[model samples]
Target: MNPLYISQKLFEHYEHIEEVKHYYGLLAIYALLLTAEEKQDPVLLGKCKTVLSRFPDHIQHPRYNFPSYRIGGIPKAYSLMKDYLPEAEEQVRYYAEEMLTASRDRKGIMSYPYAPEKELIWIDVAMAVTPYLLFAGLALGDEKYIDEAAKQTFLMYEEFLDQENGLLHQSKNWAGPGKYSEDHWGRGNGWGYLPLAELVQHLPQHSRHRTKAEKYFKDLSASLLPYQSERGLWRQEIPFEYAYEETSGSGLILYGMGVGMRTGLLDREKYFPAFKKGIEALNQICINADFSTERSCPGCLCPGDGEEKGTVKAYVTLMLPHRDEHHSFAPLMFALVEAYRNGIYDLPRDSH
Candidate 1:
């Protein structure tokens, strides 16, 4: 089936689920709306906003029940909706501003008081939170959020990037010295790519960190492109051989690269091959008729320092495991829309 049909089907199902912060249905909603060929549907957009509005400005940290991870990506979600819903824009913007101020501190390594201490902390806190703050800055046009993202991005690289190899290790102090040491996780790299690529595109050309952001975008793309498996997906662990192809990392990389190509940060000729490979891999998942559209990889606490967990098990145990629950619709929606945007899936002509 075509991606739009898949999205509509998911939306119908989502209508029955209780709206919650972590449901992340908005990610899919935005993808579906953004990719439609026709004029913007006000009603559909309103429905998205209504669901998103249910998310409070901040959630109690799951581990600490404190205010950590407050920089959730609600601002970016609202930013996407605001152009069509100006009346509702204020409310969204208000929430965005509140988050920015609430999380800001001018000292070393600004962060939420509530960064989760879970075993899977790397994925949830590091990867998930980065995009939220980056988008919050872009949507609100605020310096503080942008600065926080930049700082965290740099800090993550500093702390987790292994000197021996260029890839990001999954968490801080993960493996024994030099034994499977500092091996990159596909999703962790994917997590790093999204914000830097998008934030650099959105931030002012002359922002103080513009050069650093550019280097980051270039380095991440270069390091990751070589790892694409012949089957057109990345392995869960970069150095692991013949691992299963994963959708969530593929989608994140696809979206990041497509955005990079769209905004001119990435070279089309150099990168489009990888983009095509990832898109084809993701589309293959759709053709497989798998209901669970996302495959979870190992989750991390600090980069290079924790055990890897899968998607399904994490959700069931409410604790991190090497491999468990599926992230579900995020990778599918993100990849489908990005595939359409990049002309990889031959979306109808009007979609362009």
Candidate 2:
């Protein structure tokens, strides 16, 4: 099947579903924005404006209202929509300033500002906040916003990255203070890696931070290579051979790798085989005939309690994959769009 056609069908599938106001919903919207831009489809772009217009103001979810989580894709959406939507500039600026003043730990890392482990920080914040701020900075022409965007990711990298393996732990303080989650969860790695990919791909070439972001992106990509399953996906518990192949994380990783290859940060000769295998496998297994997706892990954040919390065992056991989960849609779209951009039109012949 054609990747672009598949992506459009998938977006249509999402449009029929109930409105999702959380990060996952925003992620799908972000994917649509990217797809429309890449394809230069004015109709799809109009759809983006219409979908975004549904959320005129950020509606706080009764739960999951952490500052970083709330910011989600608003900045990118704002950057893309500002010219079209009159209020886009104001909405993005509001969130950008909010992020600047959000709570943080003594190390200057942003933290969830609430009771019950308020000091906690995690890799997920990279996806939640980094790109948002980057877009905001670029849009507003504010160096301060741009600097904070780079700083957040760098600080998280310092705290969560496992230097020995080059894979990152999901979060800190979820297990206990000054401790890190045991498993290098697939989505967690994607969350960490994607923003750096964004930074490298979008940052001005002369920006002082681009080199460091590239290094981090390249290192994580190299480290993840050995862990890719023979089937071209990464497992839920990435290093664990027995864990199930997961598409959400795999899609995010593939998207980043595609960005790396496109920008010449990753060598096509070295990475293309894995990329080809992954996109092919994604089309073959994860996406259904109707373009509904499956096998993407559902919403998961340091699951479990007591002894099981933050353990690799819990990561593999507690976070089960489900059909048509919200998290799955965007990653699949992201991978497919990147694949299309890289001139991968169809699945491998053997896949057929």
Candidate 3:
């Protein structure tokens, strides 16, 4: 299917969706902004500017109520729209400072800002915080932000990565100090991997973090290759054979692989078949004619409460897939954008 057509339809659908002030909505907004910039479509870019204008500045934004991490996409969106939005620089700097000063564990890894008392560190934070910081740092000519962006991803990878399998656990401290969630969650790995991919793509060639980031990204990509289902998707619980095929995680993974191929960090010969199959599968199964999405896991963080919390069983059982979840939109858009970049576009049948 034509990636641009599908993306436009999805962007239009997102324009009318309500309650988009949170991370999920922000992610979709960021994806649309990225798409507009990539295609250089003035009309699409104008729509993105309108969408971004709806939010107030970073401090007064409703997303700040939860935690600083959730607002990563906000600054990321602003960074892209800096030319159009006069407040973009201020907003990006504000969030960069928030990330710099945010609470962290003894190891200096960023903790969940919502509950600093708990000192929780999760895979999700990689995606939530890293890219924006990298962008802001690059945009503002602040190396500290860039350092922190690389530092967070490297530290979290060292913490949560399972040496046995190369997959990362979803979170730490949810069960107890030094304890990690049991499952190799699909989306969790995506959260962890995507930032590394971003670093590989954006970090300067001679930057100190460049070599290590590329290695970590390549390592994770290799680890993930073995898990793709025959249908070109990943399961809800990645290593679990019985787990159902999931879209968001699959899309995120594919997006990373696409970046890898484009950047020469990953071997296209080794990865392109999977990437092709994945984008095609996502277009065929997840995105509908009207641009709604399906089979994306809902917002989940260590899933269950009480005894069931942070268990592998809980991850597979409690976090079932659903249709039209907001989380699905950005991931699908990311994969499609990457696919378009790689010259994989095919015209939709109806367009013919």
Candidate 4:
């Protein structure tokens, strides 16, 4: 089957499960819509409507019980389906503004007041919030929100970036106060790449701001290049001393590089091998036709550090064991779409 077919079939089964955070499923909806649009498949287009209908008007965050990534997904879905669902135009447009009002601070950057411990700068903030904000801004004909998306993206990078290495730390104050952790968790890198790549794609042509995002994308790509394992995968803990080879983050990197290659932001000769290696790594997934176990990084938090509070870990034990989970599948869905578009898989290479 073609990748879109396989991904659609997989997510069709997974989306029905009642997860606390439907953001992953919500994102999957956008992926399906984009794929449908690209392939011009009316069947997939119709499914987008059905899948989006499952979300509530006021999509609540699973943990915080507030508007968040769930709500952000609305404008993205709406942008793709607005013509067909013309009646929903006003409602969806208004909800986009509502999202910014609900989560933004004085500077229009994200501020989750009720979060468990006041995590103002999670790396995933860039991923979960920026694209929706950009699409919402465009859907509503408001450039302000677009500016916020760009501003917030760079701000998040400033806060989370591991300056020395270029990849991002998960968050500024994840473990506790009076401490800062620099562990470059793999998925944390995914969070950064997903948003940066999407923002770069949507940026206005000839705007200097587009160049700003492109610089960040290029720098991050260079930073991560040295870490890609010989197997074409990045590890859960990034450094070889800490954890096992992983999939989700690797998929995310592939997606970002694919986007960069398409946009001419990444050089073909320099990044092509890295992109090819990622596909080779993904082909190693032992996906059973019957949905058995497979290799993937489990959801992770900042590894607590006893030795240095939060700055460094004596032994980062938070690297969760691999399993068949959304972390792996979500980005892989994105990677396949990117690969199909970029012809990464079609490039001649020896089969694994």
Candidate 5:
């Protein structure tokens, strides 16, 4: 039941290794964990600030990049600790400018705007920027940031969600209409879930916008439950039972569900079991300690044919998904913290 100890160990081990691209998301996780522990560990906080500061100037120069926007969530960590670390205020500003710019460029009148050809559109881009948007609004005391967040947030729900099934999808391709699978994809659902569960905390409860978002989130959590694998993990493709399960997606689900329960939006009696299953799967993955965690199904914005030569080529060349354990590690640890805090699982006595 010592979540603080477990979280500290998980974070320390990961921070020491510090593999490159994983840093931003993991720092976001650490920010959540530290805030939960109710102690401000400046060392971890400093490490987090260093990672966020380095992003705009990264050799890869993610500032204007689509994938770079994914780091937008990191500012939430800064916003959590900004009063203690005043310097983080500047980093939050820097990230907000870039993310808001991206959202505007991609926004259209009747539909969400697309980012050129290969670039990320609203769904993917919004997932990346949502954390920062919420943070900027609170940190700077700027209603504009919150208003923009609401507008962009609405765009994501408008375009990506499959109205019939009530689950969210990535996007529709430019050249042709896009197809969403019968079941939700784990990561996309994860992306959708977190913003609703966490960011909604900052919005005024009585506002019409928050009420709409809560309804959407409730439906999303309900829709995602049936897709949970018997083993407590979510498959890369929820409807495609044959596809592999991905740990990062599962962890994000746990984060979302746990946040839901914490906020009283999700009915714990109905949804807690699903959340528990998610944690059980995550704990197993951690105990397994596979270096790569579990391989994620390749990232594809569109569901492509496994058949055609061109489709296969596209899946191999463009949609080829790669998996790294770094993403899985931090989220798993964060979920563990949530589980412990919720007292969902009882730790057994030592086997010895």
Candidate 6:
């Protein structure tokens, strides 16, 4: 029941695969970086480097696909690997600058800002793209990147956040019949949550933006906590019986919560149990079940069709029949790492 042991199984599953080249690749690369950091293993770092090597200059690499801002985290992965590889810094700066310039030109949004169209803002992009924004800002002693991050973060918050429930919709529609999904998709919430937690993690502690981000984190945590089921996992549609408990949402939410606990961003008394409960749930659902991840929406554009109205029915029906979905792999491994880092719970076994 070693967490690392379990994580290795998931990592090895993606080790040789090359078909995925978008968010999955970006997430897998970031997950590998986190794994390398946690293990402090050169061999693991080398493995991460191998992933980066696949796209040598991510800035110009046609495959990396710029202006999506999914490419933001990719540069951080490159920067992290700089110690192990010589050209890492150059690559990091290049992509970071290019992504910033592209967003600037696009009026501060990803190229694929929304589903089935453009200029619309996806809630997930806050997490998908902002890490590098905050990171590059801090790394280069440039408030511009950090400022951009805060602007985008707050904009997404302004657009998608439902302050009434402290929940969020999937995307903001620039031009559409329906602006966004009606239901609060669990994984979508996770996407929003993780970025705020990440801002708390990476930004200067006393900065006004960090303080605001922390408040946002706590408020969202308060909002999301009630939805956790008796099984300690959140469902696809969140607190809805129509859909089953999902792994990717659970993992992303769990990772953010665990990191919040570790960083003191979340209240220990209120959240530790929730965090521990999530890990236990994951152990029961995924770790012991041959690393199976159930109920994952396997990487598709949500609300992709005009017919697929953003309803609870649409959400539950489409986000189903999950089995070994690779989309779940990164977040689960991420949660595993953060669980280890937080030390709230150990491996499922009595002894790791």
Q: Which is the better candidate, 3 or 6, if ranked by lDDT?
A: 3
- Residues 125-242 of candidate 2 have per-residue lDDT tens digits of 8788888888878887788888998999988987888888999998888777877789899999999988898899888899999989999999999999889898899989898999
Question: Per-residue lDDT of 75-177 in model 6, one digit per residue for the tens?
Answer: 4433543455545555556666776665321445564522424465567777766776776666666777787777777667667777678888776553354
Report clash pairs, candidate 6.
none
Q: Whose TM-score is higher: candidate 5's or candidate 6's? A: 6
- Itemize residue pairs with steric clashes in candidate 2: none
Candidate 5 C-alpha lDDT tens digits along 1-352? 3544445555555555654444345444544444444435566556555655554446353333443334434543344445644655665666566555553433441233354443334254455555556667767776666666666666776667877767676554432434323335666677777667656666766555687778777788887777888888776655566666677677777877777787888888988888887776665553343223444444455445543312323323443234444655555665666776567544322312
| Residue 257 miss distance in model 4 (angstroms) | 0.5
What is the total number of backbone clashes in candidate 2?
A: 0
User: Residue 69 of model 6: what lDDT?
Assistant: 33
Give the alpha carbon lDDT tens digit for every residue of 1-352 in model 4: 4555555555654555445235665666666666776678988888777555545554555653235444436434345334645555555566556656655534444655576345444676676667877776766667876787788788878777777788887765556653456678777888888888887887778656788899999999888888988888887767654466777788788889889998899998998888877865665552345322255656555555565534334214555555557665667667767877777434232232
Query: For all the candidates, what are their Cα RMSDs to the real structure?
Result: 6.2, 2.4, 2.6, 3.6, 4.7, 3.7
With a 3 Å backbone cut-off (N, CA, C), the pairs that clash in candidate 5 are 298-321
| Regions more than 4 Å wrong, model 5 | 1-4, 16-18, 22-43, 46-73, 80-82, 103-122, 174-183, 206-208, 286-292, 303-323, 344-352
Candidate 6: regions farther than 4 A off: 16-20, 57-86, 103-118, 174-178, 288-292, 304-308, 349-352
Instruction: Evaluate residue 102 in candidate 1 and report its C-alpha lDDT on the 0 to 100 scale.
Output: 41
Winner by lDDT between candidate 2 and candidate 1: 2
Comparison by TM-score, 1 against 3, better one: 3
- Please list the residue runs of candidate 3 whose C-alpha ends up more than 4 Å from where it truly belongs after superposition: 57-86, 347-352
RMSD of 3: 2.6
Q: 1-352, model 1: which lDDT tens digit per residue?
A: 4555555444454444433334244455455455443225566656555644444454432432113222224433434434543444445445445544443223333334453221112322344444555665666676776787677677666555766656776443223322233346666777677667656776678789889888878777777788788877776666466455666677777778887787787899999988887776666543234233445553343332245333222222332222213344555566666666666545321211
Give the C-alpha miss distance for residue 177 in model 1, angstroms: 14
Model 3 weakest lDDT span, ten residues long: 63-72
**For model 4, how many clashes?**
0
Question: Residue 144 deviation, candidate 3, in Å?
Answer: 0.4
| CA lDDT of each prediction against the hidden true structure | 0.55, 0.82, 0.82, 0.66, 0.57, 0.69
Off by over 4 Å in 2: 57-61, 64-72, 75-86, 116-118, 348-352
TM-score against native, each model: 0.72, 0.94, 0.93, 0.85, 0.77, 0.86
